[model samples]
Target: MCAASLPDTATFPFETAVVAGVGLIGGSVALGLRQRLLARRVIGYDANPEVLREAQALGVVDEIRTSPGEWLRAADLVVLASPMRTLSPLARDLAPFLSPAALVTDVGSVKSGITAEMEALGVRQFVAGHPMAGSERGGVTHARAALLENAVWVLTPGDHTPLTALSRARTLVEALGAAPVVMPPDAHDALVATISHLPYLASLALTHMVARDERLSLLAAGGFRDLTRVASGDPRMSRDMVVENKAALRGALARFRRQLERLEADLDDPEELLAAAAEGKRTRDSLPVVKRSLLPPKHDLVVAVPDQPNQIGAVTQALGASGVNIKDIEVLAIREEGGALRLGLESPEEVSRAAEILRAEGFEVRGRG
Candidate 1:
């Protein structure tokens, strides 16, 4: 799939690029590099030969290797996209083969430990990176180059990291349609601990709490499903992330506990509770809207569809035929007989076009701009 467009004058910077893992994130990195013409050649390495084979067959890479070898000597850019736990050992394994001038980066969620270890290993050009984008689904088969489009990609370079290397890293991130954010490794870990790790733990705990009774589970609604979605992610990866960043996560947990304690103490004070709820709503509403590069903010079109087979397909196919691309979507409500789908479109014009097309096809369309 195509990513958000880059400028016409964008240059291909690397002669050869290597992705050390051919999983979802790695495959996406390879595809993005190839699709954007950022690398003249994309090479892939994975511990799993089957994955490498799949990635090659899927055209995610120009060539595949089961292990690091002299092949890496040609790489000017290398992405460590393996699981967090494997990064350290993987770095050491590939270090001997890496070129002295190659720019190294990783997609590990937790950064402090990996960055320190990579630096200790004498990786002179290391740039710690984490893309704030992924899916619950895993594997190269589900990978999409556009997954990183408009996503925030954090880069954490150590104090000794070379400026040239960091600049190339930022260029790579931007060329792939991601926004590059620079921050220290420790700060990155601390922030993600609160925003990312803590949420996964909460989702897990909530899921376990609600799953104890079959009766209660049957009654669970959309809110419960949405809140607990992270619990359904790859559990092993989640476990590694929480455990790896336990210190910061514990800090986040304590802060959350304090908030909960305060809410409990305010149980008899409706006014205080109302004030807290209002502040939360206000803060959430004030968050920035997603923009496609320099384009205007996206708009939504909610379409009502019947439970009849292929209804969802019909709506999307109609829009596809009209060249309307849905930026995002959510099923607002569903029942045995029908459901409401909220489709996020690229522009107000697309919303209007989609609304007209769906209405002509007899679907109930709402929320058009």
Candidate 2:
């Protein structure tokens, strides 16, 4: 970011950093603090003494506190990585110790409950967030500084949340090499149910069904292994997620069942089944493996170009020379003389810069954000 674009309040150099749970997400946050030099001092708090000692020894934190009361007042930024069940009461308990200006955030998957707690506190300094990155493992032993790199960390800020607090959350997320995505709590919960939570349940069911049939296990292939990997995640955590997000999970499961029924019906028709698989392949192939947003959401811009070779190369070279990274690009249409190229970029700044470069090169550019 340019100097003019920088916020008046500096984003880094947090006076004190506190990780409340000191487990996977919390330990990773502490490691990120040290790695980025974002905090002058780091402290960790966990209910388990062994986890705390292990985390400190791993250099995840500069110090380990027996309790939040010992360190909360001094913390300029606090990350609560505890179980969702404990968040509401914990936040209320920590409220007395936190500074008026201190920023509070969490890594909870289910957002609506904790976000409601933050709202109940009547404090604008709270920002609700959930990082879309994790392994089948849990605990600080699995935590690393690079855990969040290139991950999509969703920031669910309610209308009552202060812009400054939300921006502070974003800065911290970016510093950890994760992209910050703004979303509402209900929307985030619903989306995750479809893409994350429900999938875990599906994987678990598939794994159980195959295990019950000894013959099926012997015939399991790479596809089965890959699809069932998420079922290996911490059972206790998965149970909590299922119970907490039951409303959304039920809806997602219903949709999944409907799709499955359609597929089962198509099994009798070879042509229909083949068509469905072909369409699915095309859709899946077009999706990026990992969404690594450096600064902005990917926006598509359609530009008219001649139906000629080297035209796409010229546009890419122009944008690349101007320091604008194109996230994705595709040829849309071809007329007798020209065609349209759709270029994907991060922000309006890139769109403006890219369009200037393209127009200078005698190509018609169009932008939509």
Candidate 3:
């Protein structure tokens, strides 16, 4: 569907949003929607009352529903953000209570299984979405307002999904500062198997390998730590994802094993192995970086200012007073005379505005490449 024909941006028609689970992804979605969208009310439903209360206390939801059926009846959009195992049964139970006009979607990592169940439950408006953004942290406490910023959110709409519902879902994702890409359900699963699931499995394997050795772990530094960091993910979550995407993940692992075997075979010859290692490093370094978000253009400008303690704050205040939004700010360099601070703005206009404001306030500011 064309973007213009979708829901009007002036008024978000979703009066009440029902979030089925109040974990990290669900809480973050509620917090982001409440902060950014025009929705009148947001309510949450979780099996655990403690989680429900915590979500309410954190201001992630306007109301907490003890019974999923009660709020599910009136919600305009119902999001299933539960763990993978509970998704199918929850969809079955909540299907009858959902309003006929309500649009439903899930934040589950695996899509094919849930999409089939949702279709079986007569949820014609269901769209499967996987937001490719997460931290090693878990639970509602780790939810952040900027969690979805610059993230790639993939939507896998089923054959029966209505155009109107897909449009609304896209708008909701975009409002939370994510770029949406549409793909088929199986295709989405295949891509994530290589990029997401296989990597987690590899991390777990690497961690296990290192743990089996006593001496190597003692000497392990940043390289090993960085490579195995994802192994710290919740065991239950990792297990669920691996099981759901096993077929695709197995294929990915097989391909990866062939590469590993090649390297292992070349280990007998030191010169050949060194050449292989150098080639791998060159290929890795030459790959282009991914800039995932399409919401707004960003530009970095460097400005030199005095090294005084309050100088940074003074410049920031001046920019704020001039109504300029600072996307990011960093101390790029510190010289004997002064330091250069890099400022990231949404556009060149905001950069120019900030520069003018700082200069007018008697701070020496210049744009840097």
On TM-score, the leading prediction is: 1
User: Which residue ranges in model 3 land beyond 4 Å of their true spot?
Assistant: 1-11, 265-279, 287-369
Candidate 3 RMSD computed on C-alpha atoms after optimal superposition onto the true structure = 7.8
lDDT order of candidates, best first? 1, 2, 3
Best lDDT goes to which candidate? 1
Q: List the candidates' TM-scores in order.
A: 0.81, 0.71, 0.73
At residue 266, what lDDT does model 1 achieve? Answer: 79
Per-residue lDDT of candidate 2, residues 138-232 (tens digit): 78989887788878899999878889999999999998888889999989999989988999999999899898787999777656776788898
- Lowest lDDT sum, 10 consecutive residues, model 1, at 1-10
Give the clash total for candidate 3. Answer: 0
Backbone clashes counted, model 1: 0
Measured with C-alpha atoms, the lDDT of residue 135 in candidate 3 is 72
Off by over 4 Å in 1: 1-12, 288-298, 301-326, 333-343, 348-369
TM-score, cand. 1: 0.81
Model 1 scores what on Cα lDDT?
A: 0.86
Please provide, for model 3 over 1-369, each residue's C-alpha lDDT reduced to its tens digit, 9 standing for 90 to 100: 112233644466577788888888888888877777636677888888999999888888888986656557788888898888999988888898888888799999988999999888889889999988777677888887578877889999988888888998998888878889999888898888988799898999889887868898986665677668778878888899989989888889999999899889998988999999899989864543344344433466677777578878887787887788876776652322227776777777777777777777777776632
